[model samples]
Target chain A: MNNKVALVAWREYVVRVRRRTFIVATLLTPIGIGLLALMAGYFSTKGAVSSKDILFVDESTIFRSADPTSETHVFRFSDKNISEERDNYLENHDVLVHIPPFENLGDKKHQVQYFSEEKLSVMTINKLERAIAKAFKNHKIKSSDIDMEMYNSFDTKVVFEDGEVLEKIAAGEEDASKSGKLNLIIGTILGATMGFLMYMVIFIYGGMVMRSVMEEKINRIVEVMISSVKPFQLMLGKILGVGAVGITQLAIWLILIPVILWIVQSTVGLNDASQAEQMAEIAQNMNGQTSLEGFDIGQIISEFQSLNWGLIIPLFVLFFFGGYFIYSSMFAAIGSAIGDDMGEGQQLMIPIVIPVVIAFVMLQGVLSNPNGSMAIFGSLFPLFSPIIMPARLAFDPPMWQIALSVVILILSCIFFVWFSGKIYRVGILLYGKKVSFKELGKWLFYKA
Target chain B: MSVLQISDVVKQYGDHRAVDGMSFNVPKGSIFGLLGPNGAGKTSLIRIITRITGADSGDILLDGTPIQKTRVRDIGYMPEERGLYKKMKVGEQLMYLAQLKELSASEAKKVINHWMDKFDISDWWNKKIEELSKGMQQKIQFIATVMHEPSLIILDEPFTGLDPINTNLIKEEIFRMNDEGTSIIFSTHRMEQVEEICKDIVLINQGKKMLEGKVSEVKQKFKENIYELIYLEGELKNDSTYTIVQNDGQKASLKIKDGLRANTVLQSLIQQGIQIRKFEEQLPSLNDIFISLIENKTV
Candidate 1:
């Protein structure tokens, strides 16, 4: 039996892997995911490029007294009419830029008229506005006795451990990029993405398994197949075949997404700085206020560092396979009986598919109320729990609740397998006959 | 030793009796045709013997022991409705079926390849079954059935969809398998094929055996001492003493009534200045007897 079952499994895997559909799915997944990653990199993320630059043209009656660079500039002219200098400046610069003349003193709504050969970044926009505002301020400051650079106010970030202030890093120095919040956001996103992947694979790919079984059974090919293997063995072989195909697709996606995303990021970074500057300039341009006073790094670290991965991954994998098999096996059996052809197979599919669809529907609710009665009770149902329970558990769910759900899911899967096997054995052989629930019941209970 | 012994088996589908106490024995090394029409309990009997479906009563013996579910592995059954997984390759499907019948991998491949060559379908090995023509599909289905070399082979209308050329190809293989000591029970509505190949035969109509015996003996049991005669203008020189059955001058056929010896009639014609261009005995064909028996039962 062991050898035979292995042969059946090996045969199923090899044949399906050689199929055109499987080959297309395997190759297309990586390319699709890579494209998705590239697209995502283009929008808003850490490594994406910015596209705009603005040239400061602060011509005001107010006297200017400040330093300048490409990032921060003040329009300083030797003559009162420096319009000739602007022509020379425009001729020398190669960058596509926005040129806003700072003239209107106290406009309430639209302050300054700006012109751009292209779009501008928030950082450059803010710097240009500050330079012009400073020219107006300089005349007032010159009238008084204050020096401008002496009044440069710099903002400071505060750190706290639990409730007390931390004067220095553990390494006895502070790092330039304070990335604790960024790390927290990325980590949370990764955890949620992983959980969603499992839920999606089970709910979607399990349907694919059912459709494949329906294809074979509708054509009456499963009759020849069942004669050789026990109905249980055939069901196992099919589920495993789908698993192998799915993992192959996932493997391709895993390899290509990072590689394509890297390329897209590098490509976009080469030419555009406006978009990239906008993201970083959010710290000051919008609100000009960011305070991390008395912020505890310990809690952020503890939220992630103290996470128990020993509990989640193994349980998730177990429930995923168990749930996938149970749903797909039921589909195989029901698909076989609906009709002796593909058209009729779909009629039966709509009803059988309701469970997986309902499971997906409850996923949002699971996320919203991980411990709500609907979420908790739904996590105990075999079909829905595979998707919902693992997800709720991703965010530090109670160990006992997860354990109980897994136990219930595992037990129900065993019963479903037995029930489906009986249906598959009898259903695969019946041909040219209309099948009903009543008729299927007869086949299931009728003793031979 | 007999390869299969089906004794007093009964199968019912609801109130309808599919096999009414049918019993038979298949001696080893013979092509036994279980003859019947579309719904005449032939499939029901085949299912019981193959252990695909069980009998409501009575028992089946395999080599003198009562057959069990596990014993089904020893019986190779090719059903009337042929099936092959369309997206699956011919070689792969056959190999899987071979393993299902308990053949070791190497043995299964060797046998599958051998049969593939024998059927002239080695080129079809890697091709998907759906790509093959119906005749080619039937050949692949046949290979799947017989690849394991089970001792008992049961085929139900195995030649249903094949063209004449492919039909003859499978026909010879069936004979070859039987000659090599495989006990085969061939079921078909094509009585000509059954008549040409089967030695011992069983005829069932309306869920009951109408007749069962060696082909010659069963033909004799349905004898009417009748002969259909065909004669040209130069041949029919006879007349007044013999009653003319149905005679048109260009074409004539007659059934020899009882007490009429064929040779005596021929001599009488020879003496009567008549010519006997064609002389033949009208033996009952399996088709003739099948139609007559079925027609009788319904009436």
Candidate 2:
């Protein structure tokens, strides 16, 4: 059985690697991911595409700032009837931002209205909202002889007091870096989870293996297979063989990524490892910002480093393999049950995948607080742990938590294997019958 | 030594009895035919023996120890339905099947190449199963099955979709395997093929065994009490002693009563002025036997 399993795994690995589909997917991944990132980064970096005009109507001169630019235009009215000004602006500008006369008699509120041919971007509306608040601040500062410039910049701070100043202490660094980190984390999570996603890939692809098996069983090829190898050995070999194929393709990508990275760094000259390493080391050695002009290698390394990867890599690998085997076994079982074709197996498969699907949606929340109740509870549950634990590890989950999740995932794999095997034994040979969930459940629990 | 023994096997699908107390033995070194009509429990018995599904209440013995999940490798099964990975290449597909059956990569390649060569399809090594014609796919599938060298082989309608040349190709291989000491159980609706190749057979209909024995024994046993006589001029009549079941101009078939014989039928026909050109007992073919069995059950 061991030898057969080893053989099966090896064959699965080899043939899958050689498969044109596997080759295509693996090759397309990095390029596809890179292009997607570039497209998204370019669009957001260009500020979400807004060139529309924002007309500002002011009753008081203080409300009108010094000659608002083309993007932002301000109109002043001597008379309370601003209809004439509105008509003039409407004949030319893109949108109307009406500012009603301020009544400071008792209330600080102004009855403002905004009208446009089309709805404005959320960012523009948000900017208008802030501008209104700042206008109110200007009215409050009216006769105090206060420093408006100092106050305009008061929304920021730079404190340097005692301890080794963290780079985040640079004040606006946190928010500015926050968005970048969020997007980066999202991208990394996607890339890192590719291996984990392979669990899904294996089940999908491995289900294909099982479907193929059942087809033969339906047709009687499995009868031929059983003649030489034990059913257990055959099942294991198939799983391992296909699993190997998935791993090999990934392994090739693993080897290829570094090589590709090296080649890019060499070609571009910006990613020179030695230079990167030196800059990284120099940034690490720097105390505070002496000039604050050079790279905050900490930020670069923070993305690549500053990580609790001690927990990250191991859990990722564990969740990936464990999740893969668990799902693939079901797929195998389902494949055999379907015994007909890919379209049929998809029936049982979708229901089985509900737990994983729910976990993925909760991942955003899970990443926010690894040790939180949701993450911990979700992690303890076998299905979600495969997706949740690795994501949570980016924030450094406790050792016991990580260990527990791993243990659960491992045990779940074992249980699922035995369960799926029972189904597989019955399913592969069943032909001419469309299997149902109820029938499958019965097979899962039936005594040998 | 019997490679497979199915004792008092009973199988059901819902309320339908697919195999009702079917009992048969596939002795070592023989090609045993499991002959039956379309829904005649042949597949049910095969599935039971393969342990694909268990018999509702019965025992299937492989080499005298009850067949279990671990005993699957001892039996090779070629189902009537052809199941191959449509998108997979011939060699890779075979290699995948081989690996699953516990052959090393090198061994898988050797066996696959040998079979591919033997089937004269070595040039199709890189072709996908879908790319091949159904017959060619059959060859590939056949290789995938027998490559593992199982002791007892069960083939349900192995000749399906094969042209005469390919059919001969498969037939020759089945005989060669039998000669080399491989016990085989084959099920098909084609009666002539059974007569041509099978040494012993179990005939089933409506999930029950109608007749089981050597091909010659079944023919000889049912041959009695019926005579086919061709006469130039005669009145073939239905009498109390003999019933004329079929008559067409110059030829007639008579079903003789218990006390009567073929000679008696001939004498009665002669006395009735029937000049017989030929007089012989009609031997029932497997096809006639199968249809009669089904008709009897319906009655």
Candidate 3:
């Protein structure tokens, strides 16, 4: 790079990095996110442990008896009527559930009333409804003279096995099926996280570049700068400098967020050992009630270890730079064209913002089917590839597709930088005139 | 030898010809004035010379070599709209500009320190530009312009927002730098400063040169053979030898008749029994010449 360009870049970096806002935002954001995650975890565990106790007043003698104990709700049968229990239920039980006798077993509109001192939580209401329905079904089955063992055996679940997993199983790999499911879960999460992260960083740092350019122009320092070095050089330098700031912030977050979360988790673990034990017992009890039967943390860790991070990490960085360079150059152009009116600047931003938003919205489809035609097309196109490709990286998409996307993105980056430089050179000196897209097009043809 | 030369320069913006076939040269170590009206292509021509923008068709030679990217280090420019990063410290801003002008970091520091001390603004090194008053900022701007010590310096309306004290301070600095063999191009519509400082001038109007010469020669060229007379005794009146343009008791302004020398008019005035206190030929001021030239173009 030219020495003058380096000088400009260094100045930009130093000025921004020294700002109090930068320092505060860089160090505090991860800490804030960590605290929020911890609060969410604590609340969920607390909710699971606090089970509601209910008095079940069954006026229908035909109803079969149930176990009456569940992970989140405990039921106590009562021979007394609902009205008799409702007035005094608050003294002992959290709720009084009244199931009245009905003539029709096939009726779907039967109502069950729950009387409580406070509004019942949605989770508690759902559990009560499920228990009543199960008892009703059991009573109908018994009246029909059906064997209960044969009826219970009719409930079945279907599990999907990928071809690769089947092949591994046939080859006598013990944990192939578990690893396949784990890969799907982890890949979806990693892909979504990486995709959204790229989207956010591009906007944040790209806007920074634009604002920096506009500042120079508004300050009227642009003329002084261009007189010393080429306008193209100045623009390139600003983009690089602001990008470095973004990367530095990202790197800090990458290191700080996990560390902060771990510290908070360990401290909470040490401080609330008895609460932790209660949480483990609740989890164990809930495991039999909920459908999440095969959830194993150890298996998840192994699956994550088996990922192609060597390819994914490096490609992520490449796409990051490629995306940043392409978008920031366009941002620099728009910044230069804007005089003092910020509204006009926003008008120019629509064209650039539309593609980014489309890429983000398309991330869902890509994560759902990483090898779908829409995914292939989105990931191959340079404008959307930076966001979409990183999302599909975990799926182990064909090597040719990834390579082609990378090549296209790199070429597009070069073209955009050159194209924007043309506009930037002319626009930075323009003032007090309302610039339109038509005017910008004309500027592209202007002599340097 | 000329330090800078522009030949047949033409710059057009769409239908408007900002600079049309304009040419001039700045002699070595000379304080050259580039005088023009608001839209007379003075800035366009200056930009070409400084390599901020290229001419459509022209040659800009620095020390007889065609100007190139590398030659940017040989010239320093302060535009009509003075600007520096308001958030940047005075010392750091100057250092940045100096390095852009190709000064090494150490050389830039040394030169910046020397200038700060000379301007008695060493205390302002750490002060942000926004913290200073406008005049103080202008002072710092001037220091930034010349701190790199370019061979040629171009200042466009360099004194616009300055108070008289700071203006004189900058004016003195311009002269001192010229004395040290740095050529200067001073572009402005203000002509009195040109008269006071510039040795040579090029007056342009409508993207074309209207006048060019030494300040004294141009003033002499525009003189109309008029004279101002202050006499102690007689009341002056219009006559065949001269026409009285303005008259008062014991004072008159006369336009001498064609084919008559200035001495003949003085002889005629002395023969009228008037005791003369003062008599001198009147030469037009640059302000008058500038106004006349620009107004003539409009007519």
Candidate 4:
């Protein structure tokens, strides 16, 4: 933070922040995400509310007393023959379901024909099949004289139980199981979002730093600046400056996205009755049920509130900066080594790009098993920790592992910055030379 | 007193020595020429003086103290491959560079205004560097170099893209700055400007000093004892005292023999009844000396 370095940093930050492209990108991102959410909400709501009315030609005689209505379909038993209904059902009903008569009730190969003018949606088809199968089971159960109460009791579900939740339940905590389920969902969502976000910022802002360095070199302004200040100072100033830009954009997005989403939800979620119904249906689906009794927006909000924001938020900031610094310094080195030919730098970029790509590719696996061996190793390894460790943060991994990862990441950031400064010192003054990895290695050892 | 001094500097790049055991001095308030062919280590030595790159083994002193980071304020270097941020405004770019030299914001603004006014480029204050013509850009760059008013200024090939008028304008400014007691190191291969403005020079080749002295003294050291004569009568011919290097009907050039006086040659010409209209000794131009020295054809 010397005076000259600070001056250079201020220049770098101001120049980029004032660019038209930066302004457009910063403003458009939240709008784009808002639009995407609107589209998804619109489509899901439309699909869920488009109810189908069915004419059931029950030739098998088993579904004659079946339930008349389900979540998305209304069924009516018809007395007409199959040919009569098939030709006239389109005038009133949306579909004609003709169940074939069979002597054996348990035969798996019995065919049922469905006739519709338009292609039926996958959800509609699956629901119809399930309704017909349920009718057959009921008929067969009545004929065999099975006890209805005992049969109802046989529908058992397997619930996932973690050791901590089991201990809480033993300690007389009745809502422990409910909170555990919510934690699983929230952890997966938070980890994936955070991991992906870290991956993206490293590439986006790191590339910004690289291109800015290359621009200075190409413009040949670096030599004049170098004469006034050390190369290390210049490089550090640029990284910090562009890093500030990244943080600024992130802060804006954090505020703008929620506001925009709230506006969209109020407009699209409140005015449309069908969208409210669709959200209730999705909540029921998440609870693995077909009834809307479990749909509670307040409970979902409480679940979100239950997260350990005090730990997660600060760790996220630390990892975000650590990852950005580590990758950007190397990017600055590659940019300096590129010379006048822009294409020549691609080969040197492979080493830096590989780790980030690997971290992103491994994100899914880490989310599935946050405390597994792969997740543990990936989270502690300095190169991958910025991405993987933040992803595991929501899972509440062991405190010792988190501490170790943070320490390693901070140290690596310092090392890489110093290392890249060495390469940048020699490379900025070099022109028209195709620099290679070997050349960069030699420059790393060069005297300042 | 010398404003800057270098002693036995050696800078090696792998197997090749870019600056090999070089030494020189820039006297206070003098315009000095650093003359060398391309790749002759003139830039290497300049970078060392500017402290852009450290010399592998050497001692560089500014005002009798070893050069350090703080000394950057005392030296303004406009490198040969120099440029300004094209997208940056002329005034802001000047302010940024001024601040790097530790100028306060208020001081920088006042100095920038004075320079822009002095150069009559006040209208270009808000214009980006890329918007200016090449000569105009060069003028702005020259102003940036001197706006800090450093005790020493190093300009490498400062006049490459300037038009004749701008070049003269810059030349006048250089003379003015020197008269105000700034030590200037002018580096270029253009020998004519060196002959016109430089009081002393160091000519180097292959990273080694080949010749160093006052401009007139070096030209005298390379003189060939040749004389040009114009006359109205009599003919000239080779004799025991002098040889006719070239001859026309009215003018002749002669080279005196070793250890022979110009008076003796003149007497011989008089005895031949040559009525001399003009007679003057010829000294070599710097360009000729530079070529002969680089080509190693003459001492």
Candidate 5:
């Protein structure tokens, strides 16, 4: 590196890092994430939703068996007559449901009166209705003159003409268990988070490079700067400097996040447990599952383990550097061409940002079907690849595809740096008139 | 000996020539004034010399060697569009600029301290450029330019926005640097300043050299052979040897006729019994010569 370029980069890094805005924004972010994690942990440990206590006043003396129910509510049977015991039940229970004696046992629509000191939550009411309906179904089944064992056995078999019966135990969803579905959700969430982080870094840091260029132009330091260093050197120094600041901030977050989370966990008496375990517990309770059945802790763990970080991490670094350099160079060129007018720079940013925005919009599609044609195109296209390719890595995109994306992104970054350098050489000295896209095209062909 | 030389330099912007066939020599240890009106291409020529821009067809030599990138360190350039980062501290900005000129860190820091102390701006080391007044900023900029101890310094309108006291301070520094064998190119329209400081000058008009010579020689060359006379007594007649351009009783302004000397007019006036109180040759000022030459397109 040229000494002057190093000097310029150092100046840029030191000046920006010392700013109150930069320090505040960088330091506050990890703290904020830590706080958010703490809140999430506290809420999860308290249980996904607070369980509501329900008193059942069954006048018909039905539902003597233990209830199979959702986790969000506790049900109890009251022996005393509700009419005579209404005051006692009301004194202790906030919600009381009174089931009246049935006149016609065949009537499926039985009436029940719900009384409460305060209005029960809609979720609580829904859970109570489901429990009541289940109880009624069980009562109707028991009153029938059918062999319950035989009926269930018949329901479990699918009879064929050859007397070849298929047991329901080996049903269509034997492999497609609830846990399998949970794994898919976990994979998509992980992919989206990575994609989101890449998008933010590229977008935010890219804009920062452009603003820095505009600041130099407006302050009229560009001429003095270029006098000492070549225009390309100046732009490169700025990009690298701002990029270093970004990397520093990211590195801090990477280190600080786990430390902060550990502190938060210790504070909440949840130390010594892994994040995945807490997440599984939180996920299970969120669905109101009384037992961990149908909530796959193992499936989620395997899914997370299956993520190809070895391939993904290196690719992520490559893509981030490539994407940031390309976008930031263009931003710097636009800033130079527009001189001191920030408004013009903003309008010109739309065309440059369109592809990145498109990639973001297609992020969901890419995450779901990593090998789909759309995903392939997004991953390979230089403009979108930096964001889409890493996201698809968790799904193990073909090696050739990753290699192709990396090569294309690298070549494009080089092309953009060369192209923007030309415009920058001429633009930094151009002070007044607004430059149009047409003029910018002409600037590309300008002699060095 | 000439420390810098430009020959047949041509710069064109479309069909209009910004610097056309411009040539001049700046000798070592001399204060060379580059004088011109607005848009007279003085800035363009300076930019070319400073290597901020290139001339289409010309060669520039420093110390008999063709100018190259490394030679940029030997030249100090303070452009007319003077600026510094408003948010950067004065000392920091100066150090950065000095380093940009290829000074090592230790050398840059030491020179920065020395210049800051000499300029009496050591208090402003931590103060931002924005916090300083325009004159103070100019002083800081001047310090930054010379801190590298370049062999040649090109300053374009460096005195603009400076109060008289600060201007004098800078002027003294310029002379001192020249005395230390630094060739200084002082570019400005301030003729009085050039008269006060410049030993030699090149006057350019319309992208071409209109005049170039020692200041005394150029002044003497433009003298109109006119004499201002104040006689205490007697009457003087306007003869073929001399013509009185203006006569105000006791004082007369006479233009000596072609091939005649002022001494002849004085001798004739004494023979006519007129006592001469004062008799001195009058020459046009640099400003007047500049205007007439540029306006008339005469060499």
Candidate 6:
């Protein structure tokens, strides 16, 4: 490094690192977020599935008695007088279901009622509904006097073009939808966290660079600084210095997140052991009950693990820095041109801030359909691509799109750096008057 | 020997010409004054000398070599728009600037300590610039500018914001530095200070050199052959030989025409029976010369 640039960079890095606000914000915020993630993970995995007891009373003499028990519920049948049934019957059972007798075998009128001490879970209610539907179908068959064997032959399964392909695709879509819910929620959280950080890091540090330039310009230290070092070096040094601070903060958070998560996971793991015992007892008592078909929590977890992190992570770092460099250079130029007036600096920031703001807004649209036109445009647009592209990585977009977005982003970054450098050289010395955009346009044509 | 030279430097900003074919030289070990009114391109010329901004069409020679980017390290430039980072501590800010001038860390620290003690601001080393008064910050800036001990030092209105005591202190230091063989370029509109310190001066107006010579010679060139006389008895009469510019009962000033001697006027005044208490030839002050030159440009 040139000694002058190193010196300027070092000063910027040290001064910001020493600030209490930087230290507190960098360290405490991640720990807080980690704790929140910990709580969410713990609750989701700890005893969320439910089991219940159901009592069945059959008063009808026209039909044979049937037994229906599921893994998530136990059914106990009884023949009791209707007058003996009390309102407080739930003290012993979770649910009491009654089927009233019909006056004639051919009568279609029948009444049923269910009483539960607590509101039944959706899964438990769905299981009961399916069991009732099968019983009714059996009763209807008996009344029709159909031959059981002949009727059984008519219960044929219609096969599609290929069962394997249908099953595989259905399973794939199912896993996708399941894991999609899993990954997207997790992805959105992670993406939003990282995106918010990227937004703040770029905006805050870019503002810092701007303010630093303005400070030097206002104080007229820039003139003395320029005499010893080129304006480009000064701007680069500040960008690098402030950038290093941001990277340092991010690195600390990166390390803290996993460490805190591990602690939380271990704590939750201990609770899962006791929960397993209770679940096993419920499974034993409710024998023959169907388990939730196809939507295995384990499979969803493995899908989360299978994400292409190798590609996503490296790309994230690249875009984070590339985006930061692009915005901060323009901010530095604006700072230089603003001279001593702070109000004009803010007014000028609109141009610099608009692209990033639009990127974040487009991020919302991308979340709904990662393959949508808006998503593709946001991912490809150099200004929005840094934030949008990384978010789309969870959706596994085509490799060519990622590569193209990256190429455009890198090229745009280089162009902006050179462009801002031109303005920075002349703007630092300007004073008294606010610089308009027209003047900056003229500066672009000046000879190096 | 000239330590620095500028030949035909021109800088144009849009349709306006900021520096138009200006030229000057700074003799080695002399205190040179760069004088101009506001908006007369004094800053543009200084910026070019410091290499802060490049000249549109010209060359500047420093120590007989053409000025390059690296040559700025040997020249200390303190501009009129002086400032320091208000949040930075005095010691650290100075260290950063001194190191930018290519001084080693230990050497910079040693020199910084020496200057802080010299300026009596050693106690402010750890204090943020905002904690110090404005004059104190100026002192720190001055220290930072000179800490590397450059061969050529340029100060633009260095004493503007300072109180009288601090101003005198800086003036003494400027003189002391010049005496030790460092060429100094002092730019200011305050001609009195320029008269006291600078030996050679270049007065610029509207981006062009209006006057360039030694202070003594420039004043001599502008002399109008005016003389002031004070007597206790009578007033000298105005005539073709000498015109009484101003007169009172006992005091008068007269202008001699056609290369007439002051002795002739004195002898004539005595013949008029005026008891001569004080009789001396008067020279125009730098203030008068600067005003006349710039006003001449406007006219």
Chain B TM-score for candidate 1: 0.90
Q: Say which prediction, candidate 1 or candidate 4, comes out ahead on DockQ.
A: 4
DockQ pick, better of 4 and 5: 4
lDDT (Cα, tens digit) per residue for candidate 3, span A133-182: 78777878887789999988998966676877688767887455344555
- Candidate 5 lDDT by residue in tens digits, A183-207: 4555566678878887898788888
Which lDDT tens digits does candidate 4 get at residues B1-299?
Answer: 88888889899876779999998888888999999899899988888888888999979889898886446679988898888899899999999999987888999999999999988989888998989987898888888889999999988989999988888998998999999999899999899999998998989888888888889999999999999999998877788889989999788889989999899999999999999999999888899999999998344
Comparison by lDDT, 1 against 2, better one: 2
Tens digits of lDDT, candidate 5, B76-190: 8888887899998998888888888888889989999998888887888999999999889899888878888898898988899999899999999998899889999999998
Candidate 3 falls in which docking quality class? Answer: medium
Tell me which residue pairs clash in candidate 3. none
Candidate 2 residue lDDT tens string, B115-177: 888887888888877788888888877777688888887887888888999999999999998
CAPRI band for model 6: medium
lDDT of 5 at A269: 71
Tens-digit lDDT track of model 2 for A1-448:
6876676566556656766877788888766655554444344333353456556666554456433333333333333346765566667767766676665634666667777887876555765666676766676665456688876776765533323223454554343333333333443454346425744664566565665466556555565555445565667777777766666666777777666655544554442333433333344557422222233556655555545457567667777778777777876777777765657767777866777678777776665555689989977788777777666666545778878888888899999888888888767656678788888877665434
**How good is model 5 by TM-score?**
0.85
Give the alpha carbon lDDT tens digit for every residue of A1-448 in model 6: 3777888999999999998888898888878887776555444333343456677776764322545556546677756654565465566777787777645556554567778767775545655766775676667677689876777899675522434435765867443333334455456555666666677778888888898888788777788888888889999999989989888887897798788777776765644543354444345557623222233568556756767779888998998888899999999999988988887777788998898998888777787677899989988888888778878887778889999999999999989888899999988887777689999888876653
Kindly provide the TM-score of model 1 when superposed on the true structure, using C-alpha atoms.
0.78
Question: In angstroms, how far off is B191's CA in candidate 6?
Answer: 1.2
lDDT tens string, model 3, B179-229?
999999999888888889899999988898888889999889888888999
Error at A444, model 3, angstroms = 1.6
**What lDDT does candidate 1 reach at residue A149?**
66
The residue ranges of model 4 lying beyond 4 angstroms of the native Cα positions read A47-81, A91-94, A99-111, A131-158, A165-179, A269-297, B297-299
* lDDT string, candidate 1, B105-178, tens digits: 79989998898888777887889878988888888888878878778888888888889898889888888888
Comparison by DockQ, 3 against 6, better one: 3
Tell how far residue B202 is off in model 1, in angstroms. 2.6
Evaluate residue A302 in candidate 2 and report its C-alpha lDDT on the 0 to 100 scale.
Answer: 53
User: Could you give the DockQ of candidate 3?
Assistant: 0.64
Interface RMSD of each: 2.6, 4.2, 1.2, 0.9, 1.8, 1.4
Better of 1 and 4 by lDDT: 4
DockQ of 2: 0.28
**Model 3 stretches astray by more than 4 angstroms:** A42-84, A97-113, A128-159, A164-179, A268-294
* Model 6 spans with C-alpha error above 4 angstroms: A31-197, A257-305, A364-377, A394-399
